[model samples]
Target: MFKSILAAFDGSEGSEAALSKAAELAILCGAELTVLTMYRHHSVLEGSMYVTNADQPDDVDAIMSNHAKATAERGAALARQAGCEKIRAFVKGGPTARTIVGFAKEHDNDLIVMGSRGLGSIEGYLLGSVSHKVTSLAQCPVLLV
Candidate 1:
């Protein structure tokens, strides 16, 4: 039985499915659950690009960071509604696959449950899905939904 379960959620349909499954498993096993949302770490150049937008706020990075936090909170709420009592949510900015795997290891998670596909860009298809990379890189068991 899983003791610590981590779910990678990106607010996509696939991620929703994965989150649901993770919640169910956590409730069944009486395990701790964590919902993780990964956002892009904007570079100086990328941050500068947002400065020209008339409607965008002064601190674009802060806005994006807050959005990531909100997404993670939503995922956690969904898990709680699904009957998972022990659940936490986190948001980080980095390479998605690497971040997920690293968090799982750092948190000593027993299992990783994530979507087969997330709200990835076209580059994901060109390179690989985050789930694919996490599965290859994680030391613990990975379950893709």
Candidate 2:
């Protein structure tokens, strides 16, 4: 039984499913549920290509961080709707898999639940999925939903 559970969410369909499962398990185990969403810090060149708002040209990282925070809150809302009482949501900017694993370790989570796939780019297909990397890196148990 888990005392604390970490759920990796990206606002993708796959992640939604994983969040639901994580919520169910947290409720069953009377564990605390922590929802995490990660965003990558974009370089100036990369940000310029993706920036749409001329007003906030150099705030790409802030924009992405805000979006990630909203995504994490949305996941936490869904978990609460599923009857989970003890829940917290967080957003971080870093390499997704490594960040998740580090957060889980830092928080001493007993288990990590995440989707097999997420809102990853073509790089994920070429390198590997976040879930795959997290499973390999995490010290605790990882459950891919």
lDDT of 1 at 87: 96
lDDT tens readout by residue for model 1, 20-110: 9999999999999999998887777788777445665666667788889999999999998998999999998888899999999999999
Instruction: State the TM-score for model 2.
Output: 0.93
Q: Locate the minimum summed-lDDT window of 10 residues in model 1.
A: 51-60
TM-scores of the models, in the given order? 0.91, 0.93
Please name the candidate that would achieve the greatest lDDT relative to the true structure. Answer: 2
Q: Could you tell me which residue pairs clash in candidate 1? A: none
| Candidate 2 CA-lDDT value | 0.92
Query: Which residue ranges in model 1 land beyond 4 Å of their true spot?
Result: 51-56, 123-128
| Model 2 steric clash pairs | none
**How big is the positional error of residue 48 in model 2, measured in Å on the Cα after superposition?**
2.1
In model 2, where do residues sit more than 4 Å from their true spots?
Answer: 54-57, 122-128
